[model samples]
Target: MIHVAIIGQGLVALHFEVGLEKLKNNEIPDYGVPLRNWLPYKYDDIEIVASYDVDESKVGKTVYELAKRDYPGNHIPGSLKDIVVSRGIHLNSMKGLPFKARGREEDKGIEAAINELVDEWRSLNIDVLINIMTTEPVEPVGNAGEIERRALNGDLTASQTYAYAATLYSAKYRPVAFVNAIPSPIANDPGFIKLCSERRCVVFGDDGSTGATPFTADLLEHMYERNRKVIDIAQFNIGGNTDFLALNLPERNIMKKKTKSAIVEDILGYDAPNYIRPTGYLEPLGDKKFVAMIVEYYSFGEFKDEFYVVMRINDSPALAGLLVDLSRIGRIALDRQAYGSIYEVNAFYMKRPGPPGSKAVSKYHAFQGLLNWLGISDPRMQQARR
Candidate 1:
């Protein structure tokens, strides 16, 4: 079984905890999970061992309480009551945002806080640690040594510190995977990748590709395949989730902008003028978010064509489903001793697959690459061939 620990006990993490339990209990079908049931590991093999958060109100709450309070629909599993949201490393990730948050580092030292986290994971035997923290402004530290230094000094972001703690846990106990399901540059940071590789830990990250991001990616692939000269692209998302509130801050907003905009150049082999990022927050919308996009391109005979899309997606659960697959895949990576940031897994699930300076590919191609890496075939494709 893959024991999972969540770094940010937010909407996405809550959905994963509740939804995963239901999926294992056969109460729900795996709809949004891209590689569902195809990998060696099944939903039954996944478990939420622990969860962490820094919000003053959320620190000591059980997953069941959080879900019952925020999770839509009903039937939050009693199994979730077993896991409690503990205090996490803050590092001012929520600064400028309207939330009262504090980390153990505030009371203890950074070294102590990180050591404590490692101890908790060791006790829980966490195989995968998912970093789905609110978007924090951070840049890549290219040197692994620098990352280690900053981690000890509390100079790194919360996501980086958790990643460092995961590395420590891997080094002292067993190999593990740190699945970064946010926009922080853990996988994109070469230093973190090297650190994980040295410590025998795998990292899959940079940003979870859910809602409109993946759709726009595949759409770009369609245009590229048809040899359509894309003139420009504009896309935006407005949501009521805490993440959207966090992105309202300009610094946090830029992080999403960078991840969203990178796909254009990577997929088309040329840069296109584009505007893509979280545009606004509407509280009444709750977990469901409004997404809109416009892609203008040139066709034959110098004709200009345009594509417009508007959608409302349940953002958190969509990502939560992806986490189910990622949790199982994390165990598979450990079994294979595939340490460091894995590009194949990240390419399909992440907004910017990492190991620094890696080219982002279309989801269609990334899916094939993911399957190729696992040495497996899509069941539907297999049935069709038969």
Candidate 2:
């Protein structure tokens, strides 16, 4: 069983818990989940052992109560009824958020807070730590020593503090996989990657690729393979979630835009004139987000063609489904002694995968790489056809 700890007990975490309980009870709708369930373990094998959050409203509540509060009238399973939301590092993660952030700073500083988290996770036997925290505006640290210094001096972001805590926890206990589900640079940061490697922890992600970004990557790959000369592309998302609310800040928006736009150059081998970002937030839209895109390119005989795509998707659940894959992959990587970041898994599932300058492969190629890395012969793989 994979015992997991959550760093953010928000909608994504709630949806993830609901999905897990539903999967165990065979209550999942016939429509199917987005995850490729060909992993070594089933979704039910994952156990939510503990959770952390900085919101005062969410801090002391049990996971069940929080889920009910976030998604009122929704059914929360008994499996998650007992897990309480613990306090985590706040550190400007909730700066532009509606609620006032409450961190563990009153009782302890950064180092002590990390030590507290490590001890708690060690006692809880957390195998994986999934960070669904809000995106924080941060620049990558130069090295492990610098990050350690910053973390000790209370100079790191909330996500980085959580990562540092995960590393310390791993060093004291067995390997724990860390799946960073936001735009913060835990896995992509060279400093955190080095620390995770030294501590024998598996790290996955800079940002989870769920909706527009992955779709754009697939389409771009298709265009490149067909020898289409792409002229320009524009893609943006308008959402009503708290995440989008937070992204209204310029700094937070830049962190997200960086991840979304990184795929263009790596996939096409050159940068095209492109506009990709979270354009706005509409509270009335709720969790469903409006995604629109326009890709213009040249075909044979210098013919110009434009492709317009518009889609409305439930953003949180889509990403929450990916967390299932990431959590299990984390455990599998740990068991295999695949310390540090798993590029094969990250490339397929993340936006700006691997360290800061890693090239982005096509989704198909990434999937094949993941399957090969896991030694799983999926019949759908193009390599299998070969």
TM per candidate: 0.98, 0.96
State the weakest 10-residue window (summed lDDT) of model 1: 32-41
* lDDT measured at residue 308 in model 1 versus the true structure, 0 to 100: 94
TM-score of 1: 0.98
Q: Judging by lDDT against the true structure, name the best candidate.
A: 1
Clashes of each: 0, 0
Q: What root-mean-square deviation over C-alphas does model 2 reach?
A: 1.9
lDDT of 1 by residue, 261-294 (tens): 9999899889999999999989999889999999
Model 1 regions more than 4 Å off? none
* Span of ten consecutive residues with least summed lDDT in model 2: 29-38
Q: Pick the candidate with the highest TM-score.
A: 1
Q: What's the CA error at residue 369 for candidate 1, in Å?
A: 0.7
Clashing pairs in 1: none
